[model samples]
Target: MSFGFFNIPAPVNEPVKEYRPGSPEREAVKQAIATFRSQEADIPMYIGNEEIRTNQKVRLAPPHDHQHTLGYFHEGTAEHVNKAINAALSAKDAWAALPWEHRANIFLKAADLLAGPYRARINAATMLGQSKNAYQAEIDSACELIDFLRFNAKYMAEIYAQQPNSASGVWNRLEYRPLEGFVFALTPFNFTAIAGNLPAAPAMLGNTIVWKPAYTQVLSANVFMEVLKEAGLPDGVINLIYVDGPVAGDIIFNHADFAGIHFTGSTKVFQTIWGEIGANIHKYKSYPRIVGETGGKDFVLVHETADADEVAVGLVRGAFEYQGQKCSAASRAYIPSNLWSAVESKVKQFLSEVKMGGVEDFTNFVNAVIDERAFKKISAYIDEAKKSDQVEIVAGGNYDGSKGYFIEPTVIKVQDPAYRTMCEEIFGPVLSVYVYEPSYFDSIIKTVDQTSEYALTGSIFAKDRYIIERVSKALENAAGNFYINDKPTGAVVGQQPFGGARASGTNDKAGSALNLYRWLSARTIKETYVPPRHFGYPFLEAE
Candidate 1:
């Protein structure tokens, strides 16, 4: 396997570790795992309505426990942005008129397509490009999205079609209709589900979409399109494009028919878009809907009586899963002073088993960051934390970018709760640890409220019901999706709608009825029946 950039060795023979449904693999298992490593996943640049495939140095998915050569994506131009928006606008009306049943059928077919031919390619891409372990890749590329499609379909059948009983004398009915415009779906890199499935939410409800996938996960997004097309989706019903944000925003905001933005990214960007829409509110024929799930400075509050083992496992997975790029990743862990030593010991024991390498190497625990910029940003933060007197680098602080964007899972003990590391959204593999006395729960909650600017997701670990309830109520503004005795990430689509208020997002839970309602506008239709032939309002004479 030669990449021309450097000399590469032949693929090694290693047994693929299989985990049954009930027994999930822990991140610690990467320590002793062995597997061949490769960095050859294809990167597809989707422009307008077509896929532009290239072998240019693009980031490859790293094996779960090993290192691999780095790759890069060729940048898209402004022309690509305009074309996709035009395609979506052109297809808006037709897609909007598509029957709910028909749309649901298309989505079902897409699910089948993904389950059949596209699964392997998607799995490989996820494992290689995103450095997801095989199990993790399967969860994102297979199980979760499949659940989304199936559940949303069922919701359409049960909830979306329910009819309200009307009065016998007055003949009237209410119909919920699709928003008559195009939806702009801007997705994140961490989840392929967001790239394809989020856009489908609006599309399934008779609205067309112009979706801009994250640059890092462009390959997976293209694969999703392939599945949809294979399912016989009408061309232009869902337009997939790969372009920079500013260019896409220009096209989305300037268009008279643009409906809304389904965004999952930074809060700064979300706020910027909100302001733009506000300024141009009067220009649009109809008010556009804005749904977003932005950055999260999620936390895990561990009570003194909490299970130390659970906290350790939860914290490790929360901080290092996908290198902590997920919106729901746990960035902070607040432990009670009495339990701090136990929690720290367990965390160290768990972290000790982590392996770091290329995407194809199955033994590697930490994978490469998406690109040089992300690597630089994370590395700079690590360097800054090293110099801070109020921060202590607890377990790991290694970084290697000579081959690719890679940073070790970092854990920092905050000397002061008000320190910059504890207060900000690092958005990397940086974990801040804080310890407080159990009696100071109220003050700790207040500190979380005052410090965190973003609140998308978080979790608390405690067996006591009263403590859990009190903490839950106290951290009301902490997040939209708060967990008890569990990790903040891995939200099930139907049961719990995922999003946050304040800086986190608009709190519109994707794949839920709440989200579906956003893509639709309600219309009231009234009809009157007369004994003979004349049926009209009092002002109109019988004819």
Candidate 2:
């Protein structure tokens, strides 16, 4: 059916729009936000070509302004999950049989749509729904998502171009086939880019998907589905549903057609899903591929030679941005005693200047966390630290949830290196600092490595080249995405290729060709131009 090789457009990162004062983008986004706030959206689950609405409507609201209603989404039951699975299965064969270039083009068009017409709307939704500031929403929903779509299309082409070598009179070829059954994409609430990528990545590779997004992220997720539909994505390719996790998992994992799952969430939930899959392994046609990026106790290690100003900036930006909800956020720091005084001073000053409020207020650097649950979990850590004699709350331990789930960007100085806050993943704007003696640098590196079970990301600040090399080698296994002088968060698509190993994730490197490989099952074909007349080999007879 195809004549010649097709090349996709060269992939490039989308330019992030800075919503500076007096800019058109700022006004556009502000207007978009106001427009969204004006309407009461009645969202429904998208299954196949139908928008299914049920009696159980869950109310949605912004985290900062909980009393104000945004809209409501129709929640689904186990039967709806079954319907989604059936829809995905029904469309799987046709979707996979479609030419690779067509599939690539669909996603490419979606990327352009997001980058141009739909940018402001999607960013505004993420800001209101996920409690992110304007800049954070732009980088996540607009720029990073565009990068994923564009780069993933290029990666798909590269994957298909790989061929096998032949010897003598034999010709060999390799065909990359989609997984036999449908893929389940369980997306997170933190980043809109991730929510889009989890399902789009596999679907781009010609696999139909059953996408279940976090309830908090449905507003932006719905906008993404609209983009895909407008880009000519066929019905039933990616069925979006809002269902309870356990109920959906119970039916999906036990099904014979369940092929794989791409997940981004907590460690406990991932483990539980893995156990359920293992328990139901015999029911499936083939072993399901499980890929996930779970929790992170990410860290920052500052050397004595590191500049105090640079260290302070890294701490403030890395720890507090997006309310420290990023898996790669710097939750813990190991600062040398010599630089502690200066770093602490700068950190305190920065926190004092920071303002917390709603996303509509562009002057505010910090906004509310995702929900009340996260607020309670993070504030509990701060409360325990305040009560402990071994820990001193250097700056910001105040919190108020009456108007909104607001927690001040708090920093705790712990006497013990293995304090609860340092080891545990408190996914909020809380940073725990441990001042170590300069002589114990080697031991501190080991402590940092051994402190947390997660290996998602980390950064070390040092001016000395020798120390950098030594520390790099010594803590090689500590983090998958390690930085020298920069912060651990904000991994660019083509540049960084983010993911981690150990408890963090499969480390398949989502932004590169590596992640696309996971969705394909390769088949090798070998053909001989000339066949032997006899069954027996001449070499065997001669020997």
Candidate 3:
């Protein structure tokens, strides 16, 4: 099939012209890099209270032509993680003892740092390092962090200071306190917002944390730490380590002071961690909180009466944005057969307009996949889907890894919702569109719900209120954050508590009040002016 989707334009790769830094033609690039270098030169990585450097050189994204030069980070050794955790545990008590207002001020200052040129610098770095286009890079990096900083601090502060109810005759008040030990934050690479949420919420509530960002996005995570330090976040309140996952897991999971984990990644990893926590539940001083947002088999349900153009917009952005790397990216779309032609036409038109190229190019819409491994995975899925006799390639399904890790924004029409593409979390720019008979609407909806082990997010496009209500109620358990006529990937903080229950996640609710709750433990204190005048038991009264 041709790469073009309806009227959507194929990615036009107008190459960037090379020029010397000081040349007139290169002035903008020179300025951007200068701003980038100034902000990034002293970026700190907090290993507990200490800001340590490993002499590791941060590299920009290798040339698009140099596909063989895979970027790798200098991993934090096991010993390093142990030391960091020890420091976090040590600082927990003193950090937690600080007044809420003091902690809030630190976060607010950090927010200020995040909003300034520091954010732009970090965004530029993320763009160059991850090979993300201008919009994709900025959206996932700086903008999301701004959202997190503004909302999370305000929410946590408000909740922490909320007053307890007082009875007229009997005096009673409740107090919230931080959990006693260091928490672990394991984040993913897709969004910088996850980076902020995984650590800051807990830290805001007076809980110290050890954060291990995903290897693919370490540079952005490093930038975040630097911003935090500049904002005057106290040393040891949050720590960062660059270690292998299993090694970090061992250090954090087995430690005596390990109190909780905030994770966002694969379901298998989450289950493994959960199982380990179960095995060692008795070994811990107390129960440790495990919060995660795992894999998603997110879907977009299109009804017969839905707006075709609206659905098209949602599909294009939801399925192909970020190369469909997001957990909530719409992978499987269920459409009523009656409107299949119109919806398919519109989606095809939308896909054709998507332009993919280099991050530095302002006009490019999409860019490279994170790495070769991910690009290959997406290619394999497309190959598998193409081989099936039960599917048809509607628009695009192609990959050219000779240069950058690029894949066409793919679209496929499947005959059965039970097909592998429909059921699995492709986690790439491969959209599987399934047309269903009107009679099988309810049955198909049920089928879609059970298609995957995950239910992180889903959306429906329908103008009919009754239909919207019915489909929504039906897919209630299918997703944590459900949408109507809107893309699922962009979840606003405070308004939508982001995460899922069951296989999708551990119900951490990242952007909401519930996320802050995970960082604290409740303690009850009661006072009485007079002792019990008379005991119910005779022995007590005598005493």
Candidate 4:
């Protein structure tokens, strides 16, 4: 079937709802949480049209309230991973051949559904399942996921409309084709929006996907899957499974039909996957596209001229939000000797006011770390700092896992810039500060750039315009997403395309057309109006 060109609805970022006390949204979310807690759900793996439930049940619980049971998900074996791949491949042809507008409409419908009826449920799931506070859940599970679905659809239309120019007496056309095989979306636990976008992005571009979410995030992931299904996403277009990473990779990377991966997780895992793919290169029909956003040791740099209060606020919000679990969370800071006292006092005051507990309580700015494993890892770093003479614990170093995995938002002042905490990726609520002499600002900028292997996100706070410019230029490659007088976290979808390079990731900006292009393959078509014996050129006869 052929028709005139069509345009998708222009996308605008979804508005973040403030769940103030007594507001409808607050009441609704509270109700949703109660409803979810009342019943125990039995979840399954979505493979093709079948909801495959193996009797192997794994319990799910809120990170902040581990003693309470939420539900159980049926964990799958290697067979399910193979089945998921088969399902993705089987549906690929029909999905890719469907009119692009139809594909766009499915996701656009999903955006509306998420914004409306599904909003409270998804947000609640994130709050309970992933330990996000209500406001964080609103901005992440509701607004950001909605933005991803709507904007990706608009981007799809723009991508398809890009045609090559035609010359005199000839015609040229460019076709944007889906990848030849399936895509693997390996998502993480921190952001429900990211968990949704990882699979939804490639699937929106006509590629079928096998989505394996982090085990801890399964509760919200299931909610998102239901939304996609309700929005008329065809069965088998996206297959959700829960299996061990190595088991999935063993089959997927070695498969002939494996096409690409959209991944967000640790740097070590991504590197291992790449190595596996390279080892099995000859076993596949084509090179698989590997796109990943990995770890970050993000930083906050304070100049002597910067406002002390602003610097403190940035540090508190940037380093401690989401229990400092964000990949872009500011883990280290370089403070000038002149500003250190004021910044330290304000940061301590802010920490004193922060309450850590279950997500059900709206007043708790800080919540539990994801689980026992994360709790142990983050606490070990604090223990090491406590033992080290080179670092001073400024505030909040205590931790307890008696009821839940709660760790204080600890800050360390390190005598050495290259202290273990400063250079390492601690994916928890720990900020390490190194006070530099004001005259050594230039030298410190170089230190910031060289201290970490990651280049995900960082910020600079300064009053002087020239210092801002100078520091900005000097640390140009230090961060993928840079900020001025603001926190490094909370990147909006359209306003700031998010990603990083240099061990952090491939620098494929996720919120823009750049990320979409990775899921597509292009073909150029040309037709000549005048046909002649092309093999015999005019130069051969005339000369």
Taken over the whole model, the C-alpha lDDT of each candidate is: 0.74, 0.94, 0.76, 0.94
What's model 1's TM-score?
0.86
* True lDDT of residue 193, candidate 2: 97
| lDDT (tens digit, per residue) of candidate 1 on 1-543 | 322222112212112235443333323223212221323334455444566554334454343322444344545556766776677777777767766677788888777676655665666566655666666666677666766676666665655556666565556665777776788888887787777778888787777788887776766676787788888778777877666789778767877887888888888988999998888888787889999989888988888779988999999988888788888889988899888888899989988999876644556667776667788888888899899887889988889877667789999998788777777777778899998989987788778777788888889899999989998888898789999999888787766788888889889887677888788787766665644465666778666
Q: List the lowest-lDDT window of 10 residues for candidate 1.
A: 5-14
TM-score of each: 0.86, 0.99, 0.89, 0.99
Question: Residues 1-543, candidate 4, lDDT per residue (tens digit)?
Answer: 669889788899998889999999999999999998999988999999999899799999998889899999999999999999999999999999999989989999999999999999999999999999999999999999999999888888888988988989889998899999999999999999999999999999899999999999999999999999999999999999999889999999989999999999999999999999999999888789899999999999999999999999999999999999999999999999999999999999999999999999999999999999999999999999999999999999999998889999999999999999999999999999999999999999999999999999999999999999998999889899999999999999988999999999998988988999999999998999897767887779964
Which of candidates 1 and 3 reaches a greater lDDT?
3
- Tell me the tens digit of each residue's lDDT in model 2 across 20-134: 9999999999998998899988998999989999999998899999988889999999999999999999998899999998998999999999988899999999999999999
What residue runs in model 3 are displaced by over 4 Å at the alpha carbon? 1-45, 54-73, 168-170, 533-543
Clashes of each: 24, 0, 6, 0
Candidate 3, 232-325: lDDT as tens digits: 7777878888778898888778876788998999899999999999888877877998888899988998887788888888989998887888
